[model samples]
Target: MIRDKSFYKFFVILVISLAFQNLLVYGVNLADNLMLGAYSEKALSGSALCNQIQFLLQMLVVGAGEGAVVLGSQYWGKKDLKPIPHIIGVTLRFGVGIAAILFVIVFVAPTQVLGILTNDQIVIAEGVKYLRIICFTYIIFTTTNILTASLRAVGIVAIGYLVSAATLCINICLNTCLIFGNFGFPELGIEGAAYATLVSRCVELLIVIFYLKYREHQLNLTLKKLLFIDTSYVKDYIRVSLPVLLNQAQWGIAQMIQTAILGHLGAAAIAANSIAVIVFQVISVAAYGAASAAGITVGKTIGENNIEKLHEIVHTLQIIFLGIGIISGTLIFLVSSPILEVYHISAEAKVLAKQFMCVLAVTTVGTAYQMACDNGIIRGGGDTSFSMKMNLISMWGIIVPLSAIAAFVIKTPPVVVFALLKSDQIYKILPVVIHLRKWNWVKKVTRAEI
Candidate 1:
């Protein structure tokens, strides 16, 4: 919203970085499934179920990161780094605590944890093995994600992608080596994927720490500073962050429930959905990039008090988002048929995948707008409470119930149920457009802080 040509450069850089970040993370999941599918369809379904639970944690980490981004980005945008350390401290406190609890639960009751997701015995057995091995990643992910989001808040956007790229390379190499017993390693099968993820996460944390240390002065961050906290700053950060945390936490749990519902239909449905989800992520990478850039753009605009730029930025972003949604959705539709022939999956799963993909292609249009407005424009502008309500109203108020009814009560087709699960994307479209026109989010969140 700063309208300077340089602002566009920053936006483009952040978008590309965020897109790549999502790709690297989700690409790892896709790769794991591909490799495991080659091992066995049961292994693929089993690991995918485990990853869904892991995805919930990832969303929690992202929630904490979003809070840090909302506060830290706004403060940094105002050229005052006073609140950054305290915000990180508070976010990590919650994130680390959640990670610890999840670890304990998964460690102590691996069967129960995996059991909640699936009913198939073979998939459940593999999922239990995967869960036990991967639970350690929760805490690692908590710390790493907080740092990544916090760094991005302060204009170190590309660093996250660099770190993810390196980590992914390690993950891929490890997966190939351990999963298949290459390089004289034992064939660990599905469990090998978990080991690879754990090792890569550890390496990722170390890399993030070293990078932050090297640039600490430039970003005004330090170990002591990260460890320290100011009560007033804590309160301020909490006030602005609670809604964001709730938004993601609630949204994540709902998504997990949706996944569980799919899982219950049998391993075949779960496997099909997993493949479809991977394809959706691959095609929708640009939307993620755009959403990430939107947040930074809005936060910078508010921090800099560039009110005149609001109308122009909002209108232009909406146009760009519309195009992104349409283009990505088309890409998904175009590739689904060809992709099925290549992936190692059954005829039944392939048929279901095609059905699920058609739904994804259409729903992605609404999803693009929802992400752009809610994540980018609204949350970035410090309108997190508004976005939270929209998220809850759309998902809980609409999608969840519809999905439940479609999947259980009416016992509809898997594709119909999938469409119902995605209804929130459609529900959010017009509301976001209406809200953007009002310009309520244009107010500066950093005015009082500075």
Candidate 2:
């Protein structure tokens, strides 16, 4: 059943779809940085801090989506249509609830939320404005992503890519027009960026709805069915998905602390770190895409009862990912100077950014292996709970304490502190490599649905 050409076809399509989606999503981020950075450094730092909450919430939704994929891919592989609705229903239920809670918290207590991330009054005030306006976008974002993740589960990756690209283009155009009053547009500045995001999210939701109606014929999803509470599937989804949600949420929290540390370091540090992060994320699109594709492919293989091919597929992917890790790391290093040149940041910030970029480029080599295998191959084999534990252990246990010390106690340079903060990637490599040899990860998750 696992033909080389056919698998490659699936691999390439999903990789492109997911990679392009990352490019578009992060490209909008780059635009935000450009527009906001040009507007004011304090504003840029403010928005960056506010977006941390967004990142935290997105991780929760993505965790739910990952649950959908884990179940949906297996069902799709088994050619069973019955369980798809239940899995999606559970995912949507969680996504909607999280989005609503996030919206209320950000909208009602904007300053309170912003205050937690940064100590600067200017950044807090600016971030409050962005948070209040951007809160409205969370619901649509969460729901749309759940739907798209389910689609990706069934090998329908293009729609998400197209939808994201279209929305990002709109977001950037609106950002340009509104942020600077270009083409006779009002110069809303910070408010303008928030409005652009709000408008783009609205369009993104509508486009996703349209795609589901016209293109997702096989899923045959209805508003009633998606909203219908399947207690059984909800339980099952939680049983498997909670760890992932916690893994991401906890990881997000720890990462937030790292952000807070950087935020406190100075506005220059925030801007420099922000630029470096955006660039690294762009380069990382390929690895992330491959990870998702591998998950889907391995999940399908497991459901179809192709154990031998499953092993073969994973082993091959490991080698390929390691190679990608090396090349991507090298590539980021080679181009760092040019990339930094394009940014309008100060000489000081650029100097800091280049140093951090060096650490990122080097760490990406380890990242490729750890992320691809951890999120992809192992979890696809129905071992998410273990994956979750691994993350918690690595991040909270090791990354957090060391980062605190690096930033607080050692009082080292920003780049060295950053390198210490990112040491988790290096630390995780050994554990992941060891775990891959074990047989416990290959459990079949597609028993008859309740």
TM-score of each: 0.96, 0.97
Residue-pair clashes per candidate, as listed?
Answer: 0, 0
Candidate 2 residues 1-450, lDDT tens each?
Answer: 335887777787888889889788878777888788888787888888877888888888888899889888888889986888888888888889988988888888888877776678888888888888888889988988899898888888878888888888998999999988999999988889999998888888898888887777888888887877566777778876887888878877877888888877777888888888888888988888889989999899988989888877888889878888998898889888988766667788899989988999989988988989999998887888776788778777787788778887988788887898887777788888889888678877676642
Candidate 1: TM-score?
0.96
What lDDT does the true structure give each of the candidates? 0.83, 0.84
Off by over 4 Å in 1: 1-4, 447-449
Model 1, span 79-121: residue lDDT tens = 8876678888888888898889889988999888878887898
| Regions more than 4 Å wrong, model 2 | 1-3
State which candidate has the highest TM-score: 2
C-alpha RMSD of each candidate structure in angstroms: 1.7, 1.7
| 147: Cα error in model 1, Å | 0.5
lDDT of 1: 0.83
